[model samples]
Target: MNADLIIAGAGPAGLFSAVQAAENNENKKIIILEKNSSAGKKLLISGSGQCNLTHAGDISQFFDHYGENYNFLMGPLYTFDNHQLMKFFKDRGIKFRKARGGKIFPESNKASDILNVLLKEAKARGIKIIYNTPVENVKYKTGRFKIKTADKIYKSKYFLLAAGGKSFPRTGSTGDGFQIASSLGHNIIEPQPALAPVIIKNYQFKMLSGISLKNKEVSLWRKENLIKSWSGDLLLTHQGLSGPGIINYSRYMQKGDIIKVMLLNYSKEELENNLLKKIEREGKLNLLNLLIKFPIAQRLIEKILEIAEIDGSQNAAHLTRQERKEIIEIFSNLEFKIKSLANFNQSMVTKGGIDLSEINPQNMESRIISNFFAAGEVLDIDGDTGGYNLQAAFSTAFLAGSELKERL
Candidate 1:
């Protein structure tokens, strides 16, 4: 098979790139080869099927989510930002809404709608999509690229390796792109699970599973030094913690690290002052009852008391100065020993892939090989949980697609 451009993997990046290429160069033949039976399998499950497409905020602030690789994406993100993304869908008659934390979602509340829009655009542009065709190997020589599938050798003027990262293996993102890029002289970073839940060592909060706290702060600490911290709603899982706040910081955590959860957003001094005020007003109230008066859940209050080795039935008046200080300390600095992070099966995205230094960030093309390009999680750039990663995929694909003819 011969085409102007052959894009591997029909996920968001590949599909978006095809659409862009087809729209810009009307006579160009664009083909997307997908390993899955259908396209957008992982996208369909994003945001629990609601599909948080992009974040709604200042374009400059978007760079902060990618950490050290922020500068590498500055060009792509500025070229096609979240506003342009929303406008692109809006122009196509796809209605969307902004939710809490600036998360943009389809107004219909279905991920299928987002996928359908991309599919509709690709169809309208006459882009060809081949399903269940995985590229086994990629070769580049004499300015033309040869992509080898199971039963065919497809040649293209330009190639895009968008097979995605190792996360969500069942969805077809099994790190195939890493090998393809590696074969072409691109450095592949050791892939690790990011945006995943963390298991606690001897988790005592199993009884508090299903309990969720809003506006709580979670901090990662290593050897008495604070590594990173995030503030958001937290969910207590059977094994440990799972929520935006925990998942956002899990990428930087390792085994034996400490997770400090601040149940209440209060300093030790503030908690002590509050406890003094409560004692003055409700001196006859039981210690457990006094704790339950706080904004925390009743089950968590019981658990905290249990950890502090305090009798819940004892009145606040019976508490000694040391016991009061301990109670205050627990509420301000609840700690959990890190057991391990959940594997790729449960991860939202992969942390590492094709190293950023191996690709031209401005055009999304391979630095070592001509006519070879990549985008999305296939690269080492992974963002936070709030639609930043998807935005990166779309932005990088846009830049790559726009530069296809120039690459040829």
Candidate 2:
């Protein structure tokens, strides 16, 4: 089999590129090869099936959401931004609703709606999607590309490797793109799980699994030095720590790194002074009762007391100065050592992929090999949660598709 352009994977990147390429130059014969039996398996489960397509804000804000490769994605994101992507779907009669943190989702709250629209558009433009066909190998020979599947070797004049990274292995994004791109002389940065929950060492909050803390600062530390910090809602899971606060920065975390959760918004001195004044005013009040008055959950305060080896039944008058100092320290800083990040199956995205140096950001084309392009998680780009990843995929796919007409 042969075509003008052969796109690997039918995720957001491949499907969006096929639609855009078909629209760019009619009768170009674009085809998308998907390993899954259907399209957008990962997408279908995104945002718990709500499919937050993009963020509802100025495109400039998107730059900070992507980590180190924000500079590389500037051109593509600027070209077809969140507004343009929203307009594209709105034009198809899809209604949208904005959720917290500027997350834009379909009003119907169904990820299938987003997938169905893309499929409809693809079908409308005669862009064929061949499912259950995973490319085993990719080769360029004599100005033509050869893609090998289990039973056949297909050829195309141009190729797009958007097979995605190994985040969800069951969803067909099992790092096939890395192997394919590596075979075609592209370097792949070793892929690791991103936006994954972390298992904590000696986690003492086992019973506090469902507890959530809002608007807290979580700082990452490497020994005596502070590495990085993020602020968001944090959840204590049965496994360990999770939520946007931890998961967003989990890419930079390694086993044995320490994470400090700022449970209280107070300095050591400030809390101590306030507690001293309160103890003076209410000397007979229970120490646990005094601590609970400072905007912390009762259960968390009790756990902290337990960890600090202080009896909650002790009155403020009976609380020794040493016990007071220990409680204050625990209240201000709760430290946990990371055991490990969740595996690829549990990760929301993959952190690293094909090295970005060989790919041109202008049109998502390979600088080393002409007519070979890539987009989405297959590259060394992972965005924070809340529609950034999907937006990156669409923007890069659009950039690739908009320039495919020139190659044709």
Candidate 3:
């Protein structure tokens, strides 16, 4: 074999795998191949340029963010929890600070600093990485694997595919990993856009374009049924909607479903009573004033009032029972018809990849192909925002790297 191991993709997973492999086996030769000119291009934009390094919490908490795949992550995450990852980065001279919601970012809050730290670690270990050389495909023969680029072919005894998902093509995560894994007898789950902004068809939302609601609960409903609800800070984008609440809740929203917006972040009963109390206290207040208390803009308030058939300038005192009910309906569950989800190309994290069942969670190696391994977003596991995805990458990479040691 040309090398002991070849890792595809140069993001956090691949880079950390190279570094870990070198540290675990001194005689092991590792090489990382990245399609981009420089490594960690995606890393440069992670956490909005802050490079949220890892989360600080229990392993169960980390896995819970992945929802259904929580159990599948136990082996990898327990092998290397978030605290161990933080210590590793600190050892590499990368300072991190805990931000809101246990999100740990580099103290400098620059993605470059985090990238530089990984680059330095990989370099110090004598790990070979080729830049701008995209892997065209991989062909397995007999037992070893063949890695083919545009102009060269490399053979390796062990391989770790970390090519990531289709999101962020410019950063080199163009679903190349999925193709490679599929060809290697691994099941490939169709990728979907998670943590992406939603498409709202209601033009009334256009009036709230600049308004951002803090601590608001956003829910998804299919046929007047409650599916998912997320409460956090939300922002109204010019196109439709975004922010923590909307983005998190969007994962459960399916095609052709209408999303309901609750600006108060209160429960069903709480919101109902709150609306009734407001009407009783300020009977003469304009509709705009009542909505402004809930964080929506005045123009959007007027639009909802229009949709409710209540005069925008009508005094709360003079409002009839019918008019108040209509207004209450609009406020309690503002329906923003969901046209569709934003495309995968613009999503923060790709929702699917290699199927988890085919790989051994304890080692992150292909169940069908012994010498083959998988890690990072290339795996079926994904997570919500606030440093879960990166932790998954690290945890899986650690398993792959550590398992390689025992195998040898």
Candidate 4:
């Protein structure tokens, strides 16, 4: 079989790219090969089935969520930003709602609705979609690309590898794109788990499993050096911590790293001053009662007191200065040793893939092979939770699709 463009993987990037490329040049024969039974398997599970389509904000603000490779996304995002993305869906009769932190979602709150829009658009463009047809190998020679699948060999003038990352193997994103790109001479970065939970060593907050703290400060420390800090809501799980705050920062963490959580809003000196004022104002009150005034849960406070070796029954007036300092330190800087990060099966996205340096940021075309392109998590571009990663996929795919004619 021959086509003007042969796109591997029918995920977000492949679907969007096929539709966009068809729209740009309707004369071209575009086909998308999907390994799964249907398209958008990963999309169906994104945002817990609600599907955070894109974030509503300035393009510059969206750049920060991508970390160090923020500049590489400038071209793609600016070309087809979140605003354009929302508009595309809205024009297709998809109603959207903006939730907290500017996350945009379909009003129906179903991921299937988002997939339906992409499928509808692709179908309208007369794009051929081959389901359950996984491409086994790809070869480029004489300016034509040959793709080998289970039943037959396919040829295309332009090839797009949008098979996604290895985060969710069950969804069919088993790092096949990485292997295909590597075979084509593109460098692949070591893929790691991202947007996943971290395990705590000997977790003391197990009793407070369901307790969730909002607007708390979580910091990552490596051997006494503060690496990074994030402020958001954190949930105390039975094994460790799991929440937007902890999961967002888990990308930079590893086993044996230190996670310091600030249970109180006040600084160390401010906390000590407040404790001293409490001792003076309520001298007859017990230590536990005095400590309960903070925003933290009572059980957590009790654990802190126990860790400090301070008797909760002791009156505030009877507490020594050393005991007061210990309490202050516990509240201002609670530390936990990280045991390990959740594996890819539980991760939202894969951290590493094809290194961004080897790809043309303007169009997402491979620097090593002309007419070969890539997008989505297959590249070394993972973002913080809240619709950032999906936007990257769309933006990069749009750019690559728009430039498909030039390569052809």
Estimated TM-score for each candidate: 0.96, 0.98, 0.93, 0.96
**Candidate 3 TM-score, true structure as reference:** 0.93
> Which lDDT values do the candidates have, in the order given?
0.89, 0.91, 0.80, 0.90
- Write one digit per residue (lDDT tens) for candidate 4, span 233-317: 8888988988998887777998989988888889998888888888899989998998798777898888778877899998989
Q: How close is candidate 1 to the true structure, as a TM-score?
A: 0.96
lDDT of 1 at 228: 85
Root-mean-square deviation of each candidate, in angstroms? 1.6, 1.0, 2.2, 1.5
Q: Give the TM-score of candidate 4.
A: 0.96
| lDDT of candidate 3 over 286-348, digit per residue (tens) | 756765686566777777776666776767667676776666667667777777778877788
In model 2, the worst 10-residue window by lDDT is 20-29
Q: Who wins the lDDT comparison?
A: 2
Better of 1 and 3 by lDDT: 1
In model 2, the clashing pairs are none
Q: Against the true structure, whose TM-score is highest?
A: 2
Each prediction's number of clashing residue pairs: 0, 0, 2, 0
